[model samples]
Target: MKIIAALVTASINKPVSTTIGLLILFMLSAMTVVAEQLPPPSATTEYSKEGADTCLQCHDQDSKFPVLAIFNSPHGNKNTKHGPFSSAGLQCETCHGAAAAHTVKRLRKGQVRAAMISFKTKDVISNDEKNQLCLACHQATTTRHWLGSVHQSNDLACTDCHQIHISDDPILNKAQQLEQCGQCHTKEKVANHSVFSHPLTSGQMGCTDCHSPHDANNNQLLVSDSVNETCYQCHAEKRGPFLWEHEPVTDNCLNCHRPHGSNQAALLTQRAPYLCQNCHNSDGHPSFSYGSDDAQGQQASAFLLGRSCANCHAKIHGSNHPSGYKFQR
Candidate 1:
């Protein structure tokens, strides 16, 4: 028994290299046991619910990705009636398609999709299909004229100037449309700011309130194209059938007036006397009148400026008098 014990002791104290090899084998066996005990891989897609988590799994800090606030928006709610999960919900995917690729790139390639998926349509598709994405909801609506509008003809994309996901976008709202429009219409802004222009600063009017955004039957997208016809809508009294008539009244209002905000009172295209003298002459004026009103009335300047022709010729439209060829009262 002693001899057997001695032999066992000797074997147990084997070479350092052999002991090290056994220790390595024991560690590998323990590792295998631990690995086998771990939970198995899940088969379900990550963040299929809400999809926000998967998207933010990468988009949390991107400055250009403005829609990230969507997660905190009313549409981001999964529990409320108006939440993204509800019937009236506004899911992130509603405007932007599934963000799977966006998330994948975030985790792997820095969140850049191979190709951009803007809402704009390209030339690759038919005209119908080219606008299919927008027409999906906007068809037969106020924007129905979009098919023939200048923007459509030029292939201008809605996303080029708008962010639809942003419900409170300044440009879309009427009160802020001017500022947005001013970004591209600097000259119009300069004209609007003239000394005698309209009250554009008071926020009572907007670009769309006067001009249509898309195509219109009117010229220059005006609510009414004909110059006089448009003015008549507002100045119905000017469409009079008085016994005396001003010849220019029959012609276009634009012949003497500037409909857009103007630098002159009454929005006149030119100051008064010169404008009136385009046809009239002072052949029947009082004996005191001498120089022509056209050249600032050197001799009768005060009379011409005050009431010379208009005061006495009140019935200038067309006098009913037996001897009034000039319609002078």
Candidate 2:
């Protein structure tokens, strides 16, 4: 263990040894190397006699793995029976499993330690097994739908986004949460940087505003039953059962708007007249262009050249106006 620490410390102090330190870290992370290797499962089933006190002796301040900050976190509360300082008294071992075999007086040079549940995906611990321990306590509330969630189905452990040992977990913050999620959803990250997008990148809004990351029941991870309903949470004015209704407006918001990001204004899938032209160009709407040089002119069709169908049909979404049969309030 000292040998591993020396390598890590050298990497920190001497910039040239970074590669060597990284290699050592990678090997040590596997938990199969001699320096960090744990014993067989049979040998490590018992909890330490001193419980958390034994582990804290080495992990205290001035040690490589300092955990004093955990005292400020929920898991470290001594008052609660479920916490580390509980009366029944299984502190560090409560989540880390038994450490009795690991605290064997002193670790001699090149000797392997007892097996420990490190809660790391790439280590000897299986991701599901590591998550099961957390699920034992956090199976309710927001995590109730975690069984078949996208993050769960993708084999992501709770620790992947959560920092349980620390006082401040980045996932709790709206802006930092986007960065945590952006680690995997790279496409969304790129879209968020585009000219126009939801206020997520600016911290004014959040991914959880419309999505339930732990929910598998909702379509596209939406907070509501559908995309339009999700939009109506903020744009409630557009959700009217007006005197005149546009069929497409009641259908799906995505039919015209790109919910994430787009180059067009108002997140439209395409420009206005061309967008309205997608459906309206065929039925009594002029098929040919109303240009300057055209001799075969339909003078009334020139109104469509104003760059938007909404210019004439002001009530694009719907119209409460009595003279709004064509939605031109």
Candidate 3:
């Protein structure tokens, strides 16, 4: 009886010890699994240019983006035509740089860089760098005056006014360069599209008609810095030392003309006859009786075609004859 009891106790102890060992092994296996599933540490380093070159294998000659076009331009021929790219080591990689990190983030679902290039801030280049970039390869003639222009003072970038690609659209077309200027020149746009404006609608004239892009020593982009000189470029007939000269014409064009675009004929700021009446009296002239905005003053203003003060005083700026008071040319 004693031996049978010893045997039963030994058997029970063996199974109990095995169960305890198995439970310990199960807990340790679960802890190992949890540790393996945790995320990796954050990245602190940047990517290198060599790593970036790998992309050219697929990106070069890509139909989606033809970087080769820019290479064909003056920007790309800096080595011979210009000297900046070779001297400064400013190649295709300089502007774009290593895109590996950005590409990796997109592919592996990792963190992205804060500055993603876009239409508004595509190049990531600084404003001061713009002049340097252009001057590096191109001649300094066209953009030299830009350094002290109103646009520079206001932090306006070169890209803001000019399109690098130069689109074929009306606004981007080279011949219609004024359309680009018109986009931001709200007053010009309004005056040009106004009901009584000049042939601005047909694109017969542009901003460059009266203004120069480069080497205007006086008005930055104007053909002539002096207001009178600029005006005389086209209205050479009016630029005269006649018997009498209009004070506004002698002083400045802005005194009477808007230049950009105006609701009045020939880009005048105010309506006809009234514009004349500002200086001319109302004794017996047809304009005095008919061109005023006042109900009783002038119904003739509405009846006139061009709404031009020239309708009456054809020789507006000056008169040569002894009795040219009416400016009848």
Candidate 4:
């Protein structure tokens, strides 16, 4: 402290240099503190000696904790050089860690110790620790942005969405994917069941089609740079650099349309006329009310009876026509 004080006093005449020196010292001190706080690297255990064969003895089809089904999965494919079982023949211990204590011969009939790393066990390490085991292999690929991803920040483990030992991971299957996502996103699940929703129930579309749940550069984990860009994936016709563009449509699709689902037709945030009224309250026609009484009237009643404001403004999304300034075609 005295040495730092003396240095600061000596450099007082040169404020910029003194500040820079102080910053460097602070950074070095922080680095040293961080180094001291880090835990020691774990030592290798004996469980890797016999590979999956040893684990299969106690985790066979007949055992309560059957792991033989893993043979049907891609991880069990010994033909693939990059597979867990084939790569350096690590197999079970590659994920579960070295189980030196758990594998030891039991002295008593009722004595059973825990494995080195158990995903299902309560009070193990932590979600982050469990994720590290998976990220060790995945960090280079699909999970490249996983370090600061929303799932990582929320402490979501890889096992929460993936079933490793099973022959099929439910989250990967389109038919079963929503069920897995719905476990956490209850609101989206309910929205899919709305009167006007994307064909999620029919398996025509999936959450992953729009969202990269692993990691994304956009908000809401969208696969594209923006919500409008994501919607343009399927609604390509609406992606026009038109002669006349609807301000809200060009700005954001969510301005008038709901991505998930809605009670109104065409996934509209609200029915026409009322929805258009919110934005278009011009002098006469655009501001006119479309009530039941108007049904008794003449030509104007026809617009109110059917699609309302959309009756005349058919090209409401956008228009390429030279005379489409009002988005009416």
Candidate 5:
């Protein structure tokens, strides 16, 4: 480029004594010598000569950024198959994108900013784009259903719960997972805090045990085909091939139970007599009927003294005995 500029200058600075033929030849040579072409501003994205090493210049442990911890993460493990530093031998650029233009000094809207995708910078990458960076290598079984999932639809970023620089992400820890998910799930948190609820707060179970955050096949994000199927995993006794099957039990446990929590005992939606009356006809059985005695043509208390419907119908879920038509075997 310098040679071309010098040649052009010499051609233009020729004195009057110079021959027209010589001047014309110099002008022609200068015209033929095109300046060394450079890519336009839009095409400035190029890989730096040094990859991760370049990024470490500013992100090293001594710096405020402190990215040396990533070396201890799976992403930096060169032996891990198909990982960021695996057979492909990718570096920081593999996830952060090309740094050639980003490393070079630049200004945007009166602010000095990186030209490439630096996740910390505003607008450098959208949530979807940030997810794609991880999906580039993580689009596997667990992630297959991640697309269009509730978390994805809400523009959730993997970094929101995962700490890629560390070996153990908070979401992967049993005790920490509840709190991590609870940050955004305040309603479920309150439900789990209730007296009668799944043992989530105590760490006996995790949200992932019942809900598949990666899946959106159902509104509850249950890991199983249906609500009953999910419950049957732990309450196999309730999943009976009984001689007398309760319709509500077989249909859905939620019909009679609050899955998360409830003020009622055994997570029941309501105290039994009223709850049973929702589906059971009070006049059908004169013994437990709450209907007026005048309508029944008999006199009997409303069973309010010891009126929990499930107290007598102990096998309310189902009954294996032949004579258990009323679920009281």
Candidate 6:
């Protein structure tokens, strides 16, 4: 009777001990999985490589990459100390990150993994990360205000407008810039082609002439503090501290003129007489209805004739003459 009782207790204790051991093993496995899922530390050291030649071996012109064309670009200039191909430069790895994992051959049957940074790839780093790589070198001069720029806030990458490998970037060329900008600014493209638009299609001016794509403190990415100030860059005569100031002209150029384009002549928002009527509603000649065809023909004809209000108020922008109060002189 004593032997049977001891055997029954031993059997029960053995199963409990086995269950506890299995529970411990499962917990340990779960902890190991959680540890493996944690992100690794960031790489601090650069890759061990000589030059762009190593990358060119696999990424040639025939392999969907125009690698050789980089030799014709500023980044490929080895003579310059500041260039990407200089002695201290990392060459392809400067912008592309390390190539070891990407270049090494694998025996797997599936597609090879992307081991380097790519601006065109959707699965790579975020747009900010990609732009940071370029800003690391381009933070000076023109890019100083890039942090809060319209383009930056919109998540537009530097690679979106620039071609790193090409000798001549299309965005930098005045003749080709409109097409590149037109990709995103479709409305502006249509406006630029209007009757009284700027000479953009004629190659006389470019979008960059008035705008700073990388950074600008003003709206519309203008190079100056205001819309009128930007227009004054080319139309300096219009920028004045005249003896007599037109309130609307001084406040904003866009109040009367359209900067992009207009169907009316001289970029006017509306034809004169009607354009003047919007502001001047005083009694007498200023408020006279020129459109009326009546027996008082002479007075109405004078207002409706060629040049209209401008026929008398010629110096409409502003005038310095003592008798120029009516803007006529």
Q: For model 2, how does the per-residue alpha-carbon lDDT over 57-124 read when each residue is reduced to its tens digit? A: 88887887788888888788888656656676477877787778888878889988876877766555
lDDT tens readout by residue for model 3, 1-329: 45445445555747787756655666686688789885322121243454424434444665454344454544455564433234555354333433445434344356555342222444454565554555444556666666666666666665676544222334334446656776677676667666565455577766666666534666446777687787788778878888977777888878888765666666777777777778878566556442345545445344363445576667778899777766766
Give the alpha-carbon lDDT of every model. Answer: 0.57, 0.77, 0.58, 0.79, 0.76, 0.77
Error of 2 at 197 (Å): 1.5
Q: Model 6: runs farther than 4 Å from truth?
A: 1-51, 105-107, 121-123, 286-307
In angstroms, the error of model 5 at 21 is: 52
Residue 313: error of model 1 in Å? 6.3
* lDDT for each residue of candidate 6 in 35-107, tens digit (9 for 90 to 100): 9986432122246354576678767888877678888888888886666788888887888776565655454
Prediction 5 TM-score vs. true: 0.74
Alpha-carbon shift of residue 298 in model 5 (angstroms): 24
C-alpha lDDT of residue 280 in model 2: 81
Better of 3 and 5 by lDDT: 5
For model 4, the run of ten residues with the poorest summed lDDT: 39-48
Q: Pick out the ten consecutive residues of candidate 3 with the lowest summed lDDT.
A: 39-48
My TM-score estimates for the predictions, one after another, are 0.60, 0.76, 0.61, 0.82, 0.74, 0.80
**Model 3 Cα RMSD, Å?**
19.3
lDDT (10s digit) by residue, model 5, range 30-140: 666543343222223787787777778788778877777877878888887787777676587787776677776456677765566655535466877888888878878
Deviation in Å, model 5, residue 182 alpha carbon: 1.9
**Arranged by lDDT, best first:** 4, 6, 2, 5, 3, 1
Compared to the true structure, candidate 1 yields what TM-score?
0.60
Q: Lowest lDDT 10-mer window, candidate 1?
A: 39-48
Model 1: CA > 4 A from native: 1-53, 56-62, 68-90, 105-112, 119-132, 241-247, 279-303, 306-329
> Candidate 4 lDDT (Cα, whole model)?
0.79
Measured by lDDT, the strongest candidate is: 4
Off by over 4 Å in 5: 1-44, 61-64, 105-111, 281-305
Model 5 lDDT at residue 4: 52
